[model samples]
Target: MAERRVFITGTAGFIGFHLARLLLAEGFRVHGYDGMTDYYDVRLKQRRHAMLAQSESFTATEARLEDMDTLQRTVEAFRPDIIVHLAAQAGVRYSLEQPRTYIEANIVGTFNVMECARAVPVQHLLMASTSSVYGANEEMPFRETDKADTPLTIYAASKKATEAMGHSYAHIYGLPTTLFRFFTVYGPWGRPDMALFKFTRGILEGTPIDIYNHGDMWRDFTYVDDLVRGIRLLIDAVPPLPEARGGSVPGANVPGDSLSPAAPFRIVNIGNSDRVRLLDFVDAIEAEIGRKAIRNYLPMQAGDVPATWADASLIHALTGFRPATPFREGVARFVAWYRDYYGR
Candidate 1:
């Protein structure tokens, strides 16, 4: 039997790298698409791609999502059965400083991806969304049914725009699409800009880590492995417009509107379902590193949310799996990997 082929963007990113690696291990031919931008640390991204390059089944294309010609050619050449879009301008704080970066990367880039998918139809198209879309939403456990309009950052706004763009594409092109909104994802080979990696790096270097929001923020930190597992399971759970809608209007994959009475589109959450306080997450890292962090508490930055909790019941209902990695174990594994990776 021939192996399945997957075309994934952001293959050099933390989540993309992990997902591509897992697919390769399962005997899937993986084609990774990345711009390899200097958003954070290009060296770190290159290191991740280097690891994936070791896999015989992995092939990477260096192209920005804004480059539609390259993106279209890469997608056509790969002829992927599944297209997972994960690349984006990520960073809430950075978005405040460079909002245009978010527009080009998240909005325009996503538009190109959808256009490519339209050109070459795939079995399933899964794009990454963020819990930040919840914005100022105070819903304890955010659901797929929640209205995610009040995005706090340009980053979130761009992502929310992509969700809308994807829905329109799905409706017009009859595409089978799934949008997975992820909570605060962290683990081995994580992004340095994220809280976990920053806190770990600072604590180990004896530098005071910036504790934002006066260490009062809450995050549903989902481990990368668990997140990829959720994505893996969701591969088969394509969105189908409910039969009861009379099949009048074509289905759309909009986050708040699963209006396809006929089209295949859905939104799902991939998270741990447990919100951890910022201080508690720091403590977990401290326990693993055997060091205490000198915290510099500060006010919440603009475009930042106070807390995030995911209601992953829909994902559990669909995949019969939830991110089960305990916070302590997950933090320990990340710290251990961090120590070894950096030779600390």
Candidate 2:
């Protein structure tokens, strides 16, 4: 068999970096595209790209996703067997301030990617969604089959819109698409804006760490490695077209399956099945760093939900895997990497 090639956007981003590394190790030829946005630290993104460049099979282009001409040229040049659209304007809170960026990057940019996928008609097209899309729901664990129409912020709304776009393309073009809704993912090489990085920095710098919602928050925190592994396995579990499955159903009989009866598309939630409290998460960071955070309790910010849990059973059914990293262990590993990376 020829070597499988993957064209993945946002390779310099946290999850993208990990996923690219995993696929490279598995002998997949990967072409990465990233905007190298200043949303976080550009230097951090550069370092990630530099690391991936060490592999001969890994190549990258630094450009924004909204640049359709360049994006189309790059994708056409790569001729990938699979395309994973992971680049977007991230951050739920940031979306409240810069709503237009979300529209350009998340909505317009995603549409461009889907168009490319439709043209190439790859074996599979996997895109990223978020658990934040399950906003305002009073449910304990969010299943893929659950309604995700209550996106509170433009960031969540953008991802939700992309899910719809993907489904439409799948239905019309017979594209095999999978959109995975990720929960709170943290680990080494995480974004500086996430809670773990912010809390660790504040603690080490002797600054105050803001505990949101007065420490009443809960998250289904997933480790980056486990999350990427789920992604790697899911690449091959392409949803079959309804007619292609012939007489019977491929995933219809499976309970909790989010496969659309009209198209070769499905939505899966990738998250740790366990939800941990915000205070307990901070405690774990303190335990790992041997320094206590100067806590400043505050009300939940706008567009913030009190808790998010995922029913990850569908991923398990499709790929025979579930994220199992304990949040405490994940936090400790992150702190260790932070110390080594920053010499703190």
Candidate 3:
């Protein structure tokens, strides 16, 4: 692994930053590419990049993923053995106002990454998907084999489209591909638009935090470190080619596997597998910060779900790992970091 080179997109993003740091510590050379868009605070992204830059094995390029020329050039130059595509226009509600950004960034940008990966024939290609794609599915725990045909928001549709695109590329080019459906991920260095960050900030500043769905929401809140650890392990668990697996059989080799019968591709859910109530999450934040929150109850937001639960069995079956971080413990850690980082 010391000599291995990895090309990862969205290294400045929350999960990407943690994944890159883990790989760098394991002696893997990492090249990070991010647009550093003002979707949130550019300073947060910059600070993540700056910390990554401290590592000698880490180098980065600040460019949009939609810039095929730049993305292609960086991939070809780095000659990475693996590529993890994590950059995208993320946020469900924002997709309602700026739907085109989701189409441009998530759709076109992902296509560019696929083209580059196919051209390189890397050992593996991993990309981030979201539980949002499981839109309108009322299942308790979403499995990889579940049919996700209904997408409530443009953000969900864009991700579902990419999954199909990824499957096609994997089948047509024999590229080993893995798409991870991430649940509600939070921790220190989390995106400001996310619930945990907003709630923490609101509580500390004595502001009212919005509780959508009348605080009846539930989410599989995954810790950032745990989520990234799953990505790191999956890197080496590359899906095998069909011929190697006795002529392409989905679920033939592994029970409950979502392995495509025609391609060396599969989808895995990366989450805590523990559903947490929104009110409980908010309470955890308040408890950690040692303050009472001014709660603002609101109806469900458009493009929002009442709950999201991930069946993380496939990830464990594939890599013998599971996200086991307790929500309260993780919340405490983030609260400490938040207080320290912002001097709150």
Candidate 4:
């Protein structure tokens, strides 16, 4: 296939930065959009954008997703073959403090993205969802088809709302859409608020690191590179409309595939599919830092799930790829990057 022009939002963010880098490396002309929010540290986001700017194929726009005019203009000007919408007000706990931001960013912002895609009619419109959507779901390994109606936080609810909105647009406008539910994503350039990053920082600084749920939580910790690889593969596996699939959604017979029957859309899980204990993850970081962390065990915060494990079979079936990075190895890589980046 020839190199395609792609538009990716949140290119300055963690996952977005990694995905854009991977796409650029594969010779794709990428137009990146990010708000450069000061949610954690603007320097980290800026650093990511600067690195991407070094690539000739990367063109970035610093703007918020809530700004419909700017987003629409960027998308119209780029005229991208594929659109990856990853920007959002992310964080389960943070959502509790500011629910309105979730509504504005994830809902209104996602609506604008959908509108742009509808106008331009890209070949594939892929957006990021979260495993938190499976709130209150006790299923060991969460599947795409699982009922995710019980969202515990506004953050998850907003993402779920976006999924519904995307489906409606696909059903009405014939837009080929895919929503990938991400598990606990971690690695180099990860968010400072995430457990892995915080743990690494605290361990190196000899500070106390909070261990939520008494270090009993479990997460399907997906490495950034592995997650990006799964995404790259899925870009080519665009969903087909029901008419094109012989009057039914393709992969209905497939056990884990969540191909929608009414439209050319699907929900795939992009995760490691292996749950790692929170304490074990901390242990990995401590080992890498060569010091035991001052652990501060705490009760589970509101809207927090005890564990999350992805049923990744659907993505593997669709793209012949799966995120298989082990927690220890991925943590070590992140620690190495952390030390080098901070001059520790």
Q: Which candidate tops lDDT?
A: 2
**Tens-digit lDDT track of model 4 for 66-181:** 88899898999999999999999999999999999999999999999999999998999999999999999997799999999999999999999999999999999999999999
Better of 2 and 4 by TM-score: 2
After superposing candidate 2 on the true structure, give the runs of residues whose Cα lies further than 4 Å from its correct spot.
246-253
Give per-residue CA lDDT, model 1, range 1-344, as digits (tens).
Answer: 88899999999999999999999988999999999999888999999999999988999999899999888988999899999999998988999889999999999999898888888888889999999998989967998887898998889999899888888888777898889999989999999999899999999999999998899888898999999999988887777645424333333223344334545677788989998888998999998889999999999888888899998877777767889788899999999999999999
TM for every model, in the order presented, reads 0.94, 0.98, 0.98, 0.97
Comparison by lDDT, 1 against 2, better one: 2
C-alpha-based local distance difference test score of model 3: 0.93
What TM-score would candidate 1 get against the native? 0.94
Q: Give candidate 1 misplaced runs (Cα > 4 Å).
A: 241-262
Better of 1 and 3 by lDDT: 3
Give the count of colliding residue pairs in each prediction: 3, 0, 0, 0
Top TM-score model: 2
Q: For residue 239, what is the lDDT in candidate 2?
A: 91
lDDT over C-alpha atoms for residue 308 of model 1: 91
State the lDDT at 47 in candidate 1: 96
Kindly report which residue stretches of model 3 are placed more than 4 angstroms away from their true locations once superposed.
247-252
